[model samples]
Target: MAVLTASFFALLLAAAPAKAPNLAGTWRGGGFEIVLKADGSGTIKDSEYSPAEPLKWKASANALTITEEDEPVAYSFKQDGDRLHLSGGDLDEPVDLVRGAASAKASSKVDPQAAPGSAAKHVGPGSCDGACRHYLKCAGQPALQAQCVLACYSEGYGADFMGWFQSLDCVAAITVIAMLEAQSRGLQGGGGGGASQSKECEGCRWDGSSCAWYSQGNWGSNVAYSGAVITCNSSCCGR
Candidate 1:
């Protein structure tokens, strides 16, 4: 049924007329607002709160050949469905469709250079202060992010819908490395014997390259082993 419907729509397009690119709607970007009216005219407002100025554009490919009244002309645009990448002057932001849509928020790792300023950008204005869902811990271990999306309908499926997320604890992971590290340091002082020079250089020193049980670091072995701890040298007496 879906395929047939798509085919029917394709057939209609084959019979429809090809005319000017009718950009009659509201298009929004990072910090800019554009409104295309039915009268074939439009107005663009910059998002950075520049002086309210009129904009002139020529539709060539699939975007408006925008000309801002702020010197530095010549803007390039490429269209992908409901998104437009437009740039001229210092404006390097894209225009998106966000009119008549439900309130939606997306988490993004913002670049420092792109924000109003740096330093205070981490926890200051416009900064997301709450714990991020990506690395948030529910309990001792890792927590599972559960979400319950709620959608609303109007008179016979009206023009308003919504969705949300609810998090839940799913699994717990084992993390005892701190305790193990402490225990390993305590065992280093016991006098086993004159130890061979450690050759495992990849990570911490190991007993041998092929062995997984890594040897411990001699934090206090010098005092405990005293004469037992021989000065290490490669190619010993017996090799």
Candidate 2:
């Protein structure tokens, strides 16, 4: 009987699933950017309107727990190729995040004229336009000006929203414009845009009842909605 019991336990162990993959990289969604580290510690940067927060994380076989705001929130995640799909807790539907390269390294010893591939590039204040000049003046130094612009842009601020950026967030706008300018000159940052690059869904808007999601830059499908929140369907957004 003891031999039979041991055999049964071994079978159960063999049937168990393997642990989840290590999430030790940068992930970007529509409104959030998470940098999960190997040490279970990381930082989250919300939209330009919200301040960044540091948090600790723990991962199990199929779920991840984030300790933020003195509370633990659990999220079940699945990995599909280069995308990480997360769902649960406050999320009505799964949110897909594309894996990005590691965050920019510290700038203390970084060379100013290294290369365009370098995360931080020192630009003279005179190179900025009128809109960017206002923010650069307050930034004090040219290095700080560039850092400020990159910081805001990295937080996912680019196009001018209705009330998202009036004048205070001009730094973010300038950074995005500069990147576009560079791309036009065949000097795109982070190499040329590839399939991994995130593209904004064109023509995504609310009709009268449901949120309309577009595929191929035009209206394609509508997702039902009753609450104030509108969730994008994975079929449409999970590219």
Candidate 3:
């Protein structure tokens, strides 16, 4: 339960720009899919994230902003024809994406006014609501509580949580404790907490239902101790 210092938040606020480029399209790369709409609303799907995570986005001339719930994370971006490149945020390295056919309901037209997007939709610090709810679900399973809580916080706080704490020694301590707790609880398949007992293979990313491993370099999965699987990357833990 490490707290993010005020300076960290200040850094994020400073990274934001007054405007953004139109990124209305479907972009896919690695194990993630991002759909940016014309109206400033968007959805990001990643094997490591909750399915179809709702988001708001905007960009300056060279930066992209992604707002989840109500918190905004910024990344430098460049659009070249059908390819989109992104750096910063939670990425250990830059990610490249290719534009694909969007869903029928997805719009690509850019409305300059709509670029303001969903920021006004939320009042204050609402992302915690989603994170807290997920933490509660994980709490039901005694063996997996810590791992689950970690995941909840990671998603809820986004870069704020991941960018800071995951790089600390406490993260490893948390993972080790979670593993020991699981053994002490005698984790079995389909336990009383309704927790899944599936183990993530090394170098694979768990997509909630399955583990996906990519051959490309610079890819790794988060520590999944015992049956409580919270998959991310070693970079996220500052390995």
Q: If scored against the real structure, what TM-score would every candidate get?
A: 0.30, 0.38, 0.41
User: C-alpha displacement of 174 in model 3, angstroms?
Assistant: 17
Please identify model 1 stretches exceeding 4 Å from their true place: 1-18, 48-51, 68-74, 87-239
Q: Which window of 10 residues has the lowest lDDT sum in candidate 1?
A: 161-170
Model 1 TM-score, 2 decimals = 0.30
- Candidates 2 and 3 compared: the better one by TM-score is 3
Candidate 3, residues 72-124, lDDT tens digits: the string is: 99999888877788988855557666677632222233221111110111112
Candidate 1's residue-wise lDDT over 1-239, tens digit each? 99999999999998887666655566654434567666645675432222234556556444455554343255566655555556543332432333323102210222212221111111211101111121122222212323200111111221111000001011110111222333344346345333312331122222332322232322221211111111222222222
**What is the lDDT, from 0 to 100, of the residue 81 in candidate 1?**
52
Q: What is the lDDT of residue 131 in candidate 2?
A: 28
Where's the lowest-lDDT run of ten residues in candidate 2? Answer: 113-122
What digit string (tens of lDDT, one per residue) describes model 2 on residues 14-87? Answer: 99888667788877663456778899998775333334467899888779888875768899988775577888
Backbone clashes in each candidate structure, one number apiece?
7, 0, 4
Task: Estimate the lDDT of model 3.
Answer: 0.49
CA lDDT of each prediction against the hidden true structure: 0.33, 0.48, 0.49
